[model samples]
Target: MTYLVTGGSKMGKSTWAEDLALELAKDGPVHYIATFKPVDAEDALVIARHKKARAGRNFAVTEKHQGLEAVVIPPGAVVMLEDLPNLLANEVFDDGDVSSILPGLKFLKALAEHFIIVTNEVGSDGTVYDALTGNYVEALSFLNRQAACLSDVVVEVVCGFPQMIKGDGP
Candidate 1:
């Protein structure tokens, strides 16, 4: 099962994705691919919160901000990708272009028995961002669309509820 989950910030997307991953994982190994790298105190808090959430969940977490092709996850592991926005940012600002993610995306699709990808919904705030942010939004939008196309199920979580936008429920 491949699920592409998206929602606004703090809208329970991550929690819902985690639960779904657990269900799909069953007795299999659960691997978490974290895209965010902590660069400040606030980032530390976010990391801590994620740690608390995954406590005792038996998740083998890997942080890959770039070079996703080099990931070492076990084949057929249930994979949970925390978010795509940060991954795309790292790729855009540091490593490579947005399309650079395609190979790694294909690799994951081939390796994982179950894949749950989480991303944020953007460009709806109606505030004009600078050129850099505008470019980022456009790139991420493209990335999310690609993910949705690859996914067996695409869901948008709103107010702690998942509204399925594609495919049947798992």
Candidate 2:
């Protein structure tokens, strides 16, 4: 089962994805692939909060910012990719390109039995920004579209409620 859960910030996508991962983990181990690269105190605080929320969830956290091909998951392991925006940003800022994420996404699709991918909905604010920011948003939007197409199930979290857009509900 491959699920792509997406929404705006603080829309409860992560929580819903985590719960789905736990449910899928009943058949095997659960791997939490956290892609966020905290660069400041505020980011660190957010990361800490996520860690605390996931405590006692029986998840093995893998802090991977890139190179998803190198991640070796046991066969049939349920994997939760915390979010894709950070991953896209990392790739974009590191090499000024987001196409690098495609291969990694393919690798992940073949690696896990149940993959729960979390992403944020970009370009929803309708706010115009600088060229670089616009590029970032474009890349993120592309990534999200690719993810949704590849996913077996697609969900959008709005006001803490999940609205299924593709496949059967989890």
Candidate 3:
């Protein structure tokens, strides 16, 4: 079961995805694939908060910021990808390309029986931006669409409430 959970920043998507993955992994191992590579103080703080939140949850944390294909996930593992936007950003900034993200997403889907992916909902506010920001938004939008199409369950979190856009509600 591939589930895609998307929302704006701080909208409870991560919390919901974590809870779902824990529930699904009651009988198996839960692999928490954290995509963010903390490069600044703020990033480190956010990562720390997430670590605290998942403390004692028995999640096998795999901090892979790039090369998702290299991550060795156990068979039939319940995997939760914390967020996709950071991964995209890393790829974009590192290589000035976002096309590689689609293949990575496919690899992750194939690696687990139950995959829970968290990503951001960009450009919904209709705000104009600079050239680079615009490119990032376009790329993220495309990736989100692809994920939603492939996902068995697609949820949009708004104001801490999950609105099911595809599949049955959990």
The digit string of per-residue lDDT tens for model 3 on 1-170 reads 99999998999998888888989898666899998988899999989998998888879999988777778987788998877898898888878346667787788888788999899999889899999999999988998999998899999998889999999968
Model 3 ranges off by over 4 Å: none
**Cα RMSD (Å) between model 2 and the true structure?**
1.4
User: Weakest 10 consecutive residues, lDDT, candidate 3?
Assistant: 96-105
Error of 3 at 76 (Å): 0.9
* Model 3 TM: 0.95
Q: Could you tally the backbone clashes for each prediction? A: 0, 0, 0
Error of 1 at 128 (Å): 2.1
How many residue pairs of model 1 clash at the backbone?
0
